[model samples]
Target chain A: MWSTIGEAGEFGLIARVTAQFPGTGDVILGPGDDAAIVTAPDNRVVATMDLLVEDRHFRRAWSSPEDVGRKAVAQNFADIAAMGARPTALLVGFAAPPDLPLSWADGLTEGLRAECARAGGAVVGGDTVAAETITVAITALGDLGGRPPVRRDGARPGDLIAVTGPLGLSGAGYALLEAGVLGPDDARRLVGDSAGGADPGWAACLREHRRPGPPYAEGPRAVRLGARAMLDVSDGLVQDLGHIARASGVAVDLDSAALVPDPALVEAAALLEQLGAARRAPVEHMLFGGEDHALAAAFPPGTDLPPQWRRIGTAAAPGPEGAVVTVDGAPARAGGWDHFG
Target chain B: MWSTIGEAGEFGLIARVTAQFPGTGDVILGPGDDAAIVTAPDNRVVATMDLLVEDRHFRRAWSSPEDVGRKAVAQNFADIAAMGARPTALLVGFAAPPDLPLSWADGLTEGLRAECARAGGAVVGGDTVAAETITVAITALGDLGGRPPVRRDGARPGDLIAVTGPLGLSGAGYALLEAGVLGPDDARRLVGDSAGGADPGWAACLREHRRPGPPYAEGPRAVRLGARAMLDVSDGLVQDLGHIARASGVAVDLDSAALVPDPALVEAAALLEQLGAARRAPVEHMLFGGEDHALAAAFPPGTDLPPQWRRIGTAAAPGPEGAVVTVDGAPARAGGWDHFG
Candidate 1:
């Protein structure tokens, strides 16, 4: 077994991590330099950053190091996808306690590389340091491929609202995890079992919570098909839609019956109820729970929708109460993850 | 007085910080979106990231929030400059306790904007989250301006080693701050005073420790002047030079007598001696102290060196011992900051 990070030292640990990520053709220079050089190709780049801190953004008791790393990269890459851009590279800055096990770090590097490969990008550079707690910060860069970036403010009053991925599964998983119905250790065990022995639906939610599978390819598809406005569903569907509402100066109305929760979420909720956990309706989770990484976009009225996207709502002119989001002709509470609050 | 971050909430604090940074021309799309879009005119970008954790990379008791912010941006920007690129934009990820004072966050934003301006860039976007401790991670992007990057492996046997910017001031300052010779409060007071007032040398060291001013323009200048290889002296002069020597497969020999210590560092050393602090010679500090953010490059021998670059050494064929760097005809110990150790 390898020693702790303190015993392994910085350079040795860096070497171990870098060896896990092979250089891609897009990277002119990779790790071990003062900086990495990457091709932008389209003469413009889209960039975003996200921070994940232990206990605040994640709990070690609930999440494995690999899960944490995947979530960190997935969230940042989702931002790039939301802009209708294809991700090019990622730069990561990581800090953790000196006494942390080397296996934890290696697992994290593996997770990072796996997610970047799924997102069609590479980890170009990174920095590592020792701190009191584990913190992972990722900055993702994307190429627009000569197309104008799809922005939230481009939505118009008559646009159609749609999403390209499943909703509320991550939130349902969180509720299950919080209730102790499914622990992280159990999820890890299920990962190796091709067919989850007893409850596949619950197992699916657990996997989604650990590593979200965003529809990265759907972003460019939406752009090529003329997406008018776009954003990612990170802080709940209602709360995230509110941003588009305010930015585009329009009201968004979702048809409650049109909004269908994933079948896995329904199964997970049923299992939680059977386990004597407090039952949160799947629809409630869809409205208020976050971290789905689903790409939401507004298309021009009468535009042909992509097969991956499902219509959930429509945009309208703002009412006297100002630009807002509503469900089934009633105002939905704007509640979601609030970092400071 | 304004309340803490918890009282202000994440969006409110974000609004305050974003208001401090007006969008620059390079930023096609600024904050409040899923991601930001910046023009990358050169079709390529140089990228790097760095993490600053409270108490490990900085201490609230020893450095102000503004200083911490400036240092974070400056160091990452220095990495881009060391690659012979001109910085164009920055994406920052900040995490802190919810109860942290809003004033501290605001001061940090101001500092970030100030440093980006100095480096000829803009804070295009960022993410803010709550955590147990303060952690600032910055990813900087730069344009190569149609020039090839000066990498670490490009030096030849007959190259002259040179440096652009002051050396060891930050290390001496670290010594003073560690010794409590100049507290954060005293350093703040000295910022407004132009005269020596009680101890100017200690004050200079404190400033350098808080914020570094690397020769950003000199990096591109060196590339234009046909420099063979380059990097920033981040982890002490000797330790950083070893990286170049190892990469280029050559032995670098430094002339110790040619190295000059800054007058402020000499004065700081004398003051520490008077105060009975452990006596570390100024020359020793110059050779071993780190975090100066100075540019070190190798130029073709007999090249007309720029006035900003001072000759320090020469590159030669690898020695029989397989050692890479030596000083004054003897091996120089490679010692510098090691975060994990």
Candidate 2:
């Protein structure tokens, strides 16, 4: 095997990168063709795309290739799931430097394969090109199972808002990494035998940040349970909820107690505090942090919810203040992740 | 309006860029949500993705933002077309530096809109992020209209190889730009009016390079006409034909006469020669140059071809040489576009 992609060459590297990728199941035509065909059993395709740029979305110094690969797929699948669909296939567009290690590509492929397997999908096709930096672009396709898509504009006044998974864990993990409390893969590189012992909470936070596992099935389950509005909490719960508010022409209010920080995030907050780094309350991360990839939805009042989905907020008729997110019936600081900003 | 993306911010920029984009066609759910749903109609989705990186795939100094946008969509659409499918939706992932002008993004959006209109599709949804360089990733979803996908592994012995449109003009145009002849927009900036007078042939070549108009309809037509195997003539006709040859277990031999250079390419070749650049014949460009994105396919011998398709070669049962592309019954040079190589 060649050490570098430049050495392996395009065709050779492509063959190597895609050799053992699973092709059975939903894929009618996989890689090595002009295009890939995936079954759209409902005669509709729920598709979403995401881009992971090195240094912007991820840093190689912090994340392993596998982690980035998993993240790329996870982000896109979250979008598909948010639409109440089950993912079927992913088409990747990878651009990396020629001198990039072939091993990294292999690890990335493994991560993509593992994630696709986890989501009941396959990596059907991809294009590879040489560039100065690594850019992973993924397109995830899903099927809605003959149901009307749950759109963001469906949230009605008096609907209860619930989250399908933990919120702000990735952001907390990111805060830890930014302050040198690295993830398991590079924890030693950042802090050589840090002053504290190994912490499972910290590890969990790191894992969540590096390889988030969105509740893919819960999306369809929520739809079947008659949830109205749903979205992936990528740009913070407060900010993303604002999207539902605006789209549905309603005002959203979060219950402070329901938005309590997780134990892992509390520990992450404590670590940052001890490090004398910039600090914020654990709930602040939940409020304004991003990249959690958790699904948040608005369900009709009196709807029975699964134990896994935590009721966090409620939608109400918009007041004179128009559509926005508030806490405890009061306006909360409005902030969200914006790449350009 | 804000001048730079950084000034406009993510929300403002997204609103501005996507405000005027058309969305009433095959898209079931367009932007303003986590995912876009496109109608598949026949329970199958023909999907393809492609990436364009600044400086590698295009030069801003040569290609306008509009040109890059057109190229990005064209490449992915060609893949869908090659699969005998009609594109329905496109999801874009755009990453650029904060310093980029908002007007550039506007121009890019216009180009995306124009091309999507041409292909009978809509720009459904996209993810925008900040990066050090510009990268545009596009995923095109297509409907097959209840037809079986035309694959690259179906060419039988004695099948005639044909091309759906002109080839090598993009490569020739690339040669012109690389040698300072430049496209219409950048030509004045590069050559300083020293090239005697404006040339229509060179302009056509530049258009091919900057904004290749792949005869998309021809792809589904080929499939309907009973094409045995087909592929997009990206990375050169010879190199791409090898895909079908290898996949179908056939040797492909080109009719040198049938592979005549287009007049536009001949002019480009002459210009490149006069500039003392690395010289290549127009036929050489036809044989080895790439990025034309025209469709190439194998059909049963004596199958009547439409006027648009030119019979270029023949597929035969593999000899000792295994699967390969030969010219004039002799082994031809096997050079083509390779990103790493």
Provide the overall lDDT of each model, using Cα atoms, as 2-decimal numbers: 0.85, 0.86
Candidate 1, superposed: residue stretches over 4 Å from native: A183-197, B183-199
- Summed backbone clashes in each candidate are 0, 0
For model 2 the TM-score comes to 0.95
lDDT of 2 by residue, A170-244 (tens): 888888888877754345454445524555566777889999999899989999989899999998889899999
lDDT of 1 by residue, B97-183 (tens): 888988889889988988988998988888889888898899999999998998999888989999998888899888878766565
| lDDT tens readout by residue for model 2, B1-341 | 58998898887877876676657658777787888888889899998888888988888898898998888889889999998999888888999999999889888888898888788878888888899889999888899997778999999999999998779898888888777766554555654464435565667888899999989999889987899899898889888999999999999999999988888788778767767789898889998888998999999989999999999999999999999899988987887777888
Which of the CAPRI classes, incorrect, acceptable, medium or high, describes model 2? high
Q: Of the true interface contacts, what fraction does each candidate have? A: 0.94, 0.96
Q: Which pairs clash (backbone N, Cα, C closer than 3 Å) in model 2?
A: none
Q: What's the distance in Å from true for residue A3, model 1?
A: 2.6
